[model samples]
Target: MSEDRISRDTEVLVVGLGRFGSALAATLERLGREVLAVETDEYLVQQWSHRLPVIEADATNPEALEQLGAEDFQVAVVGVGTSLEASVLITANLVDLEVPQIWAKAVSAEHGRILRRIGAHHVVYPEYDAGARVAHMVSGRMLDYIEMEDGFTIVKMRPPRETHGFTLGESKIREKYGVAVIGVKPPGEPFEYATDSTHIGADDLLIVSGDTNLLEAFAHRP
Candidate 1:
């Protein structure tokens, strides 16, 4: 799904309260969004009932989803990945209900393809994504890495010495490195949006964005 699919005012319907589902629901709620979670396991329902709005029901059953008003939500997440059959069924039911944005978790490439063919608006491989992000972080100076669509990435990293004490325009970071410094966060101060006049400190953290390879090269600078 596109980034605009879920906004600050969106209420989410989360199916399958497993690890991925629970974390998604909890984080959404913590961020001040309303969430309704559905789980097949009674124990899981009971465990999270005190913390979130959860119900004990099988999401594979379209009737159950309808009874729980699944069709009423614009955004629905299928977090059942352990069993391929159950995951497919739940995603299909959401599709039948015509949910505007459906995000499904897939364990493998085949599973993701099936989910997309069956109308899942977005398919995420959490394990693979996390592994890739961690690999990038460990291999360079990046403290955080987010790979977006079409090989674009945004990273939080320390500024290289070549950029220290120079303004954005003076350093010509975009021209030389093929990347842009979006913002700078000096120690003990809030992050400020970068401009041509912005000066970077040696210890300041940078919010950089560009193509994945170019960002890697920029972040790897000594």
Candidate 2:
């Protein structure tokens, strides 16, 4: 989906109230978007209904989606990944409804390819993404990490001792370590945008960006 595809003021239709679906719907609501969630499991529908607007229904049936006015929604999210048949059927049904932006969750590459073939605008691998993010955090000084396309990454981490007490220009971090320090947050101050004259302090937090392996090497420094 394009960056401007989903506006904060837009209403979203979410099918399947599983862990991923419920979390996404709740987050969208928190972000000031109206969300209408549909679920096949009665218990799940009931459980999440109090948190957001939800109804119990089988989304695999195109007729059911038509009744629910799915076509009226500009964005639709199919969060059924456990059952491949169900996932594919729901995504296909959304396509038939002509939902302009469809985001489907896939458990495997094959499922993702199928969703894309059927016109799903976006496919998410939540499990794999979460595992990768956790793997990075547990193995290094990184407090947080976001892996981007083409091996690039942005990380929040503690400053290395080699960088302590030196101005960015003097340290030449990007030239030496191959990672750019984008921002810094001292122990109690607001985050500061990084500049050539910015001094690296011992206890400051750093937001760094670079190739993933280079980031790992930089973060591993003493």
Worst 10 residues of 1 by lDDT: 1-10
lDDT of 2 by residue, 93-201 (tens): 9988778889999998898999999989999999989998999988889999999889999999998898899989998999998999999998999999999999999
Question: What is residue 221's positional error in candidate 2, in angstroms?
Answer: 1.1
TM-score of 2: 0.96
On the 0 to 100 scale, the lDDT of residue 118 in model 2 is 90
| Residue pair clashes in candidate 1 | none
Runs of candidate 1 with Cα error greater than 4 angstroms are 1-8
Q: Judged by lDDT, which candidate is best? A: 1
How far residue 90's Cα lies from its native spot in candidate 1, in Å, is 0.4
Which run of 10 residues does model 2 get worst, by summed lDDT?
A: 1-10
- Candidate 1, 211: how far from true, in Å? 1.1
Per-residue lDDT over 148-218 for candidate 1, one digit per residue giving the tens place of the 0 to 100 score: 88999999999999889999999999999999999999999999999999999999999999999999999
